[model samples]
Target: MSIDITANDFLMGGGIKAARFDTIGTTVGGPITTQPKVEQQKDLDTGELKFWNDGKPMMQMVVTVQTSLRDPEVPDDDGQRAFYIKANSLKAVREAVRRSGAKGLDIGGTLTLTYTGDGEQKARGKNPPKLYSATYQPPAQAAANEFLNGGQQPAAVPQQAAYAPPAAPQPPAPAPAAPTAPAAPWTPPPGMTPEQAAAVAALPPEQRAALGFA
Candidate 1:
């Protein structure tokens, strides 16, 4: 295994950071969107492309977006920031759009990205915590009006519907209870005399029950 540094190695060593925002709100101005590019790598020493452990080309689809920070107090790079969606989050965004009935995303159209985390991703500063989720916010008329009225903020984009998981199957309904049958009148045991049977029958139901006669 040979390793060598490229002339642009210094420029390629930076990490991606999440846009700092106070709330989950509409991004200012529509984004300059780009299609996901397939991930690739080259060996600095051999100048050969690398493949995955399975002998297949290691590839990834990334959706990169740049938008304004909603919160004025939130710090951004030159008043804006770029977000990267890859791996599972990328799949989630695509599924979300499909469920919303949109064929695809349009460049310069209003879109919003929101973040949620349980602190694990937040702890790693290399990448914005993988978006808990991403959404396509459609531009609204009122938002357009506000944008045209000298406001830097554009009209609010309406969020597409999120993907809903299918409901789990319910347990099969319980079987119907067996029907009850009427009890026959009690009869005297074998060889019992008429008087004996009458006396036995005259006893309280509890007493007769104790005698095993119903």
Candidate 2:
């Protein structure tokens, strides 16, 4: 009698690393087969669970993608086939998926994430957050069949249109103010005494204007 074992039986779990988007234009992408999971946030320095001031642990959503994409700074033999995304970067991917009319991200589709630029600066002396853009390409019929056939060659498929986010709205320009007539030149009243006229002349132009002398 013989026993049959599939390749997945010998696969090890854990050790998957997150992808980096440290610079502008940096991109990473892969096919998403599973739904995103939520987990407790961990402290970067100590690898301990991070908690809020009220004693509750901070939570974060994780989306893992399987791909051959590798960071140039990492070693070739690292065998890093999967990467996870969370935090603000995850928001971008969620928005893209929503805009694509998909109910959720796990559509067995490819997800591309690009670091577009830096976001608005927060408190003074603190670094600005990184901004990202995402694109989701649904799996083609040929590609799905190729996977089911155990790595067989896939048939050619027509190109699908890429998604583009709408531009930000701008504030309308202000309207010009109406032109005003210049004030008439000031003169002393004809019935005033010479002393009174001299006194009025001694006052500042603004005071005379306020007193209806202008």
Candidate 3:
């Protein structure tokens, strides 16, 4: 008998880091591999567990996601990296998932958390709490062509030209001007003898007017 083991199994032993939102505009995200769970909160300064005034332990939600993003402070570290979500950040993530139409956060989907800004300070000498927003992207659905072709790719469809209105009708060209004829040369008046007209034509302008032949 043979047993199978992978590098990921070994990498999981290194433990996952809780995502940080120490500064405004900080963003962290990746595909989720584990679902959210409520866990007891621990004191950051003493490394000890914490409890409420009523004797119940304070708790927070933990989620594990696989990411390739490297921490700037640990640039040399090149191993499988995971991040855990907690507290109010978990509420933001849940709201994002719900808005995306998902029933709940599921494995193989991406969840991005961003620190937007600080909230109002509630008391003196205490810093304001960081505010966050989240976005969830569900896994991509299979295309219709893939299903119809039994997982084979379909040929590309040709693009059609967009519809355009026909151009306005152009006015008909103006009709060519009718051909014109030249005027005839001046002729002698009716009842006037040609010889008399010739004599009138030879006379000076004042004499012609005196003879009534102007």
Candidate 4:
């Protein structure tokens, strides 16, 4: 943050030695990092307006105006204030600039004003800094497609379809047998076959001839 001091602070910091002001703004040749200057139509044609291109306007300016914290969004008429601040009244700001050791003080950058917080002096809005900046954007360098594509090419894709797995099947069951009934009680015959009976009969006849009737 820039240290803002009051007029008394400037006096305490050290008394002023010398200061310079131009009727017009400085000439801008190439790109400027930072500098202290006020805005004015006359300042535009002054020594600071370098790299003068007649075609590109809006970018052109008398001087780049610096802003105070209170009016950062909109730069107050600091160039006008600078013009108004006379020889004796400007002592504090001049000394503050000297103490800073910088070559110049930009608008809204750093300054020692002639008022105090509790003193009779009421802050008339707020004094803008002495230094400021402005950016002159050279027209767009690339086209929309150039920005979208940069340096790369589009990727390739396949035409064939993808493979899928087959589905599973189920199994069948067996048939049942019929139930059987219980058997009844029974008896077997004790008699012999017909052939055995014939043999016995013939033997009996032979025996009967020998003995009495068989």
Candidate 5:
């Protein structure tokens, strides 16, 4: 019988402690099982800046997601798997898969990872704890008069951020507003999870009729 843990035992879980961000949704037990590996992001200011830059251990990109998010600390009724690590959270899931027009980034699509407290506060004074900005979306298209709306089935997408050598074009910051729909109460879209509707009924009837799910 020996147990002792400090830091006030993590404040005894009294709740009301906001400022730990990262919990937006739209995954619901299927698609995007894995991709983007490259780990080794030791916290504590990258372990004190990798001890004067010899250790070189600050990388990210984890990216796994299975969302439902009723989240009483994620008991797993096929929900809340969560990862999507840094590099600005994988560049907001590759700009929400290029705004869902998607030329890439899929795997049972329907991403929508939002958090946006208008970001920018990683450090700098009194309370300093807000760097929220994730906002992805990607996976919505079944509007030919919504035939019982199947909408969202792209699957197998995760490969961007590699061709970067063009730096020098700053001065284009004025086009933000239009992303509000993730206060987090998810589980829609025929609300999947009969193991995501039997993995979209075993995907193959013209790829489930081109993702509209025939």
Candidate 6:
């Protein structure tokens, strides 16, 4: 834990406000094209690297390309290298963003750099470009909300009250009936005498239960 992190480390860590990486720095192998040759009259010829009478010095140059992450880990290889980043928004050209990605602004390209290194080193390619991925998936609904306004907070659902069957509808009130003229006083058969009538009338309810004659 006593290790100290340099500014380059933070930029390469790739999580925040300043610069972000689209590709990690890689060593693109090949030769560093030396500066073009300038011809000089040899020391009176003989025993010197020679060209024809008008042999302006010529040297063959080899080169390869690779991109690097912002604030990359310095490559251990040799030769001049250029880093490339996929544009996020054209607005990213802002100076703030440029500085963040300018960790190794030492070579040449859109931005020029002078690499003091002797040669290109051996390195490999990163699996994918950073622009190929995103940090998070914002919620779908949240995106819709954002479109409508600025942002949206999820809403809480209300608790529903328990349902009750409507009161079994009330029964209609009973209606009143018309009065009867008096059941004509029941009369026994004409042959029947008062004595007989009395005898029958005196009978107990149980004696004529079928007709309710009590």
Ranking by TM-score: 3, 2, 1, 5, 4, 6
RMSD (Cα, Å) for all candidates, in order, is: 30.2, 31.7, 37.1, 51.1, 21.7, 41.7
Q: Which stretches of candidate 2 lie over 4 Å from their true place?
A: 1-13, 33-35, 53-56, 71-84, 123-126, 139-214
lDDT of candidate model 3 versus the reference: 0.58
Scored by lDDT, the top model is 2
lDDT of 6 at 132: 22
TM-score of 5: 0.22
Clashes of each: 1, 0, 0, 20, 8, 11
Report the lDDT tens digits of candidate 2 across residue range 1-214: 1123233421332456677777899988776645555566677879898898999977655555666666576676342344344556778877877776666555356777889999889889977988888887544421332243444332233355999755657756658977988956545554544544555566566555444444
Expressed as tens digits, the lDDT of each residue in 59-152 for candidate 4 is 2111122222232443542322222232232444455445555444443232323322122333677433334222221111111122223443
lDDT against the true structure, per candidate, is: 0.47, 0.60, 0.58, 0.30, 0.44, 0.30
lDDT of 2 at 76: 64
Q: Which ten residues in a row have the lowest lDDT in candidate 4?
A: 137-146
Give residue 168's lDDT in candidate 6 (0 to 100).
55
Q: Which consecutive 10 residues in model 3 have the weakest lDDT in total? A: 140-149
Better of 4 and 5 by lDDT: 5
For candidate 4, the lDDT comes to: 0.30
Local accuracy of candidate 3 as per-residue lDDT tens digits, 104-184:
665556777889988889999988877789988653211121122343333343456899855667766769998888844
- The residue ranges of model 1 lying beyond 4 angstroms of the native Cα positions read 1-30, 33-36, 41-51, 70-80, 118-131, 138-214
Q: Clashing pairs in model 3? A: none
Model 2 — TM-score against the truth?
0.51
User: Candidate 6, residues 156-200: lDDT per residue as tens digits?
Assistant: 334469998666597666588778777554343344346434544
